[model samples]
Target: MFLEKLASKGVTLAQLPIPVVRNEVERLVLSYAQQRQWFLWQMEPDGSAYNIPTALRFRGQLDLAALQRSFETLIQRHEALRTTIGEEDGQLLQVIHPCQPFELARQAVGTLDEGALQAQVALEVQQPFDLARGPLLRVKLLDLAQEEHVLVLTLHHIVADGWSMPLLIDELVSLYEGYSQGREVALAELPIQYADYAIWQRAWMDAGERERQLAYWMSQLGDDHPVLELPTDRPRPAQQSYRGQRINVDLGEALGLSLKQLVQRQGATAFMLLLASFQVLLHRYSGQADVRVGVPIANRNRVETERLIGFFVNTQVMRAAFDTQLTFSELLAQVRQRALAAQVHQDLPFEQLVDALQPERSLSHSPLFQVMYNHQTRVKGERRSLPGLEVESLPWRVHAAQFDLTLDTFEHEHGFSATLTFATDLFDAATIQQMATHWRNLLQGIVANPDQRVAELPLMDDTDRQHIVDGWNATQADYPGDTSIHQLIEAQVFATPDAPALVFGEHTLTYAQLNRRANQLAHKLREQGVGPDVLVGIAMERSLEMVIGLLGIVKAGGTYVPLDPEYPQDRLSYMFEDSGIPLLLTQSHLRETLPIPAGLRSLDLDGENLEGYSDANPNIDVAPLNLAYVIYTSGSTGRPKGAGNSHQALVNRLWWMQKAYGLDASDSVLQKTPFSFDVSVWEFFWPLMTGARLV
Candidate 1:
């Protein structure tokens, strides 16, 4: 009955035509339905309830009759205004429907107060529309006073994005002037409608065009997905959400022009200069030589799509490796070539690219890129208001995607302004503030002396560098005396024998108990023909036994190969076999999971026989130069290469930390990182050697 009534009102299935299909258009349609399902939804599938896009403003002493006439002329000039959607063949489609000009509804308010007028306008504009229905747009006007008025326009996302709003505003202004002057408006005929562009896009993509583009992307982003190693103060969430805040950094005209000149001298674009600056900053901040950042590309290569309103944006992962010795100009040249290559291969959709490259999607973040850099040079002209009215525009609501960080750059009249939006859940505001300051200093240094070598660029002022160094300096009276790591550990054990020294899942061991258990393990390894130069595998979970076993292997004059219990059985077996381990220390829980290679002796710390010897501490002597441990990080061949570290290296690190942080028994250091990560080496051993408490 509702369908019949709507049909009688000239809104029938026969009236609309299905829109042309394209990849982005199809994605947009599906995404709209999903958003409606999950987020904002208030209307049913009835054609009567619809949402409209509007721009609201106050117009003082505006003629009501003239405003009505202006709207009628605006509607007549733009065919999009008269277009409506209707159901056809069970799918919603757009139809050009005839309508009696724009209709105006006026309600008289008893009071002439400005606050009352705005309240009424807000109520009307806040009215929800059923986007699933045919009518998905609306406009309202509320008179605050005889001379003051508010204009509100609301529309569904299906019809527009940020790009289309400016177009609508430009046309509306011109139409208003023509209507007020009673003159025939001369407007250029659009070459094609948005639907036409959609059809063309589908045809182009179907002709093997996208496949070639995707091939380029794959080649550029190889197999290695380097992680951005930023130290986190808190445990990271399993997934990142789009909850962020913005920090705007202003680059004055002097600095901006200097940077432009520097890049130009190297025959590069300003983007190259900015990229080099960021790469250098990342290296200094994270102490990493390689960095990867996501760059957004406008993907509107086709002449047809330039004017077409749609979401035609794609992202490219850009990886930069820094050499501290390279000159600024040389780095800029390299960055220029790489950026050009990225632009040439920017056709692949970010989501599709990630899917194709990374088989393991369990990672907490995107494997390709976690940070984004957007350089948007386009800007819309300032809007002119209707006659007898002043207008002001402000963004009311906005939606952003999930990313660790995003830097949006726009060119202002004076210079460039970078608006950095970051996830608050992951980063503190102070960190972002420091990042901004660092970026400014880096850019200013480069701009001042473009010919200087990158190594020569002042990354930080001497005062700041000294401050950082001072914070790391560990020279205080409360600090423990210069003592060997082993001696320090022995002293702690003797001083606090009953204090808990190691805590793993479900098990906590006192220093005395840990020392005795480790000694027992060392004795067992010695009995199994293990000695100096032998690599014993600790194939166990993160438990008290794992820690004891590690110290025991070192104490007994043997290197420990940490075999993560979480690794696949095949990989674990391969590592143990490759390392030629003669003895393996593990708990009973993981015994069944591990493969017992030939000639590999196993000692289960949880077994009954080892329980009796747990209290027997064997004070074995080991040299600092003896092999302490071996860690296997990722390599290009999909195989892990072991980096052997001696006890001397561990001692050097501890000594460096002690000298750096002024460590004392009073300070508590948090042990937060996984043992598999290199950060654990410093977090765990530094405090133990310095007599500082490990929290």
Candidate 2:
């Protein structure tokens, strides 16, 4: 219908050679945009983070008119500069506009200062472009002074990528010089345009080629793609804000040299080492072994496509597995292998790969990875000089982020300059600043000792280490040296004799009453040859008598070995044999269920024989370092093992708990945990030492 309207105006649309065949890459991009409802943004637009802003500061005699003419010529040379991306017949189409008068917007900001000029440039970058319209690019020239100027260039990502930035600049320099000299620019003729290459790519990717590349991606990513839940300063909103800022980081010359040397020694490229360091840093922050980072690759592999300006960049997912046992050198080698393999299979568009893998897609976050890494070291030379003008690239913040974090590193004369750009909504400036510092520290530590395990790399400097180790662990206080667990309880007994110390369903015992019961049981056990290094097994239902049995074992200077009666008889028999318990204390009904060791006595606490026992504290001399208990572990992974803990260890922990939580006589602790687990030891001892009631 639009062609018929053009024909009525004496414009033959069919005379033009613009092809309408959909390209594979463009088709996939259109499908993704449609699914996300991004086209609706054309009606109600949001200033997306997809805009690429580049500004060059020039300090010399500048030719504004000649520069503007040069930009117009470059637009005529590249059809992509005059192209619009829109949908026709429910498909993505690149409509090419005929070459016409093009004007670069120029503004004389001679009255404004440097800071004000930068603010104006930022405002220009924040403006959103209508992709469905004719022009998807813009340029502005700000005259800061008579001899100084700032040239700003902005483009939508649908038409251009990072590689195109340098190419565009280099061509602009040549064209500007030619127009200034009033001479014809002698440049080579183009082999094809971006649209032609896109069509060629779709034809090249046959069924066999698609399957071969997809299999590698599927095997590499596997079933699980770990999404990082980075700690954010503010809660994430239901939708992304795309707000972002950048923090500058530099690796000094000495460490940078060491890094290069280390990379050479490991037979890997600088990119692999940097990526390994990044993965290690993420591992330290997230404690996740699986690390995936998005890397944009220059997909212009052919010689013909190298010089053309187009969106030829493809994203490759670089997944690095960080094993604690692997050394930094080993990890670097693994990263190198994965990187090289990805470069080989770089032709697969990231959108297609995502479709093939079918990862759990979400609108709140990116799929597969939440962080991106890119290196622009190869193109630093292109930024040095623009014909006659001394060109210096201006580093400015993009008010948006495509991912949670993006680390862009560029090589320089001194060492390397790294900029960490992160979403402002997810992270504060301070957090990213610390992360930037940590990344540098990690690089320094790994270079200093590449042979060390990756997990052993020091992520913090001396100041941070001091703050964490010394500042947080200032928990020192005076504790008694000659006292044992029983001695502490005895002191509490003297202080609060009438306080309720133990309670179970309707049965309760005061401190004095509980001590007398334990004393009576201690005397009876002492008569049975139970002393220091002796083990007494206590197996009973949870009751007030259970607390008495545990205290009696410690009072008699014997190690208590608790066996849960509900456990299988096989496990109970193993614990008795492992600890070599000399005496078993239980109710009369449980005596038949347990396997009694030879020459070991099984005493029933409910027996009438205990009526003759003395209810006095025993005069036992037990040291603080003596064994307090021998707990047997469940044989889930291997053979069941018995661990012996000392009275000093238990007393120190209970003292720390008292000071940390301020536990006192007013507190009541729940003792529902089974005695077989180590957690139960702290729960059993914490209350008695703090003069708190246990139930």
Candidate 3:
């Protein structure tokens, strides 16, 4: 073996035990399996997103043998590379092979096609790994052109995680350099293998530590576990498919600088600012006070575990309670406290914590939380430069999302990039894109105005706000200018004298006849000084006479207060008192029973002596801003309240209804609402205003 060859050259190598203990996370992973095959680590790559693949691009690579030897040395040094998980005595165990010959699959392409190479990498990442068989890791070498070569290393997540990638690459670079220059590679020996850490974790949790930790998590995540109500394009399926896609967004230079300054001012890191902003955004979208996000942590707290490469990554549920009254600065402080506490209690595996918390289990949703937040600080400046090769990390998609949404923020030399991975089954491309835009806008608002409350911060720019407000409500149209409701109706009477304007059952009044009849009533009303500022109570039933009385009051330059005759006598009396009307109009049949106050006089429309009154318009000088009508609220309390609207307000509303619903003379609107309610005012006038019949 290449490692044996290196050993013969006086290089000391560490040997792992034959069968070692599987870690706490490893055992939990085995429990996630649905079948015995999955328990044995026999994963079906098509259904699950468990594999971890990393690609490294190397330019001007000349020594293939030295590179191959470096990989072999890496496997010999780390027991994880030669490790495979299997079942023994009804328990999962990791078995490490003593040694094996190192082999790298070589593919030589004449032309350097980056797209082709990426496609190959994607296909390779999805390939299933046999956990019981050998070779849980694969190294594929692609020689593109002469000097450009790519080394793609794919490993199962059971042995590797995001935090282990850098360590693995750093060790590979050191071993490769030593082999290329024929110099001795002096690397420090690992104090313990991953198996030892696994054993220690199991024993430590079983001892009283787990109960203390579980109690903390239990209290943190209360009994009411609410799912995030993120608006999606499609309804959630009966079961989660884990099918996902990604949207990329960047934090621009200006905002990024401002965020950094804000972070410094708050005595926090950029990560804390990002997380706080993220929680604010989630709260705004979902309207939930308790927000829970799963954040992955590099669980390498001990000095010995820091240098070792294994699945040392753990997830911590970072929960923050948002209140609309809390300022952004206050929310950030709360987020910081929660994040620090979660980091302190990062030892409990996510699986074990789920078991302890015992939240309502659902196959359609993930346990505890559905949103994941991750921040990766890439060390681009500290990247090692090989002797004759230029090495750089290549981006590749490993698998779909395990959660409904995963927000990945990567810090680079210039600024930060945010990627939102959303499930395709639940969300559409445009929805996720809009979400990303809102995320950027939220960060900008936070950095610009950190003292603003989370609920007050603007999530949309001016253009977006305009589109929602002005663009959607762009219903302006020309109507009779400087016209009151009576003048507008009079104008319509002149234009369409014979058109049916008022209809009640089989009775129909033409525009001319309705105008003439209303004028006769108005002439009598003007005799009683029913002019501007005068309110006349029209306590009438739903009939044609009620419509004529309302029109006559408006025609006399006075606003009519609607008093429903069917209401209780006390309520009607309260409404009449609140309105303070000097005159009342009703049918002759109800005049005796109507609750007319002592000083208020009543005129029955059906019994009025209108034969002597002039059937001409009163010609009262009424401005568009004059009060049109007053509607009293039902006396749910002791006293009723009256709300008055001006003729201009009613005209504007009628114009909007005309434009919105396309009301015309052919349309018949039902006017069945009670007269005292505000909606009755619109119902009584909207049909007449737009030449529509009120049924």
The whole-model lDDT of each prediction reads: 0.62, 0.79, 0.78
Cα lDDT of model 2 by residue, 213-248, tens digit: 888998999999888877788876666667888787
TM-scores, one per candidate: 0.55, 0.71, 0.68
TM-score of 3: 0.68
- Indicate the worst ten consecutive residues by lDDT in candidate 3: 28-37
- lDDT by residue (1-695, candidate 1, tens digit) is 32343345465343322233322243222222222221323222322112334445555555556667766655554434554444456555445445555667665554555555555654665565554443434666655567655567765544444445555666556666666666666666555455444344434444455687778877766777777766555556775544556777777788777766666677776666676787777667777667788886766676544544333455688777777677777777777888988777665556556667874553356567777777766542344566666655522321233477777777655567787777766787688877887788888888787767776677666666887888657454433333334556767788877776665555666777767777777777777777766888877765566666777787677887878888777777778767887778888888778887866777887773665443554555666566777777754588877778767667776766777778765676777876656776677667656555555
Comparing 1 and 2 by lDDT, which wins? Answer: 2
- lDDT ranking, high to low: 2, 3, 1
Query: Across residues 192-278, which tens digit of lDDT does each residue of candidate 3 receive?
Result: 777666655655566566787878888888787778888888998877777777777877877777887788899987788898889
- Please name the candidate that would achieve the greatest lDDT relative to the true structure: 2
Quote the positional error of residue 201 for candidate 1 in Å: 0.9
CA lDDT of 529 in candidate 3? 87
- When 2 and 3 are scored with TM-score, the better candidate is 2
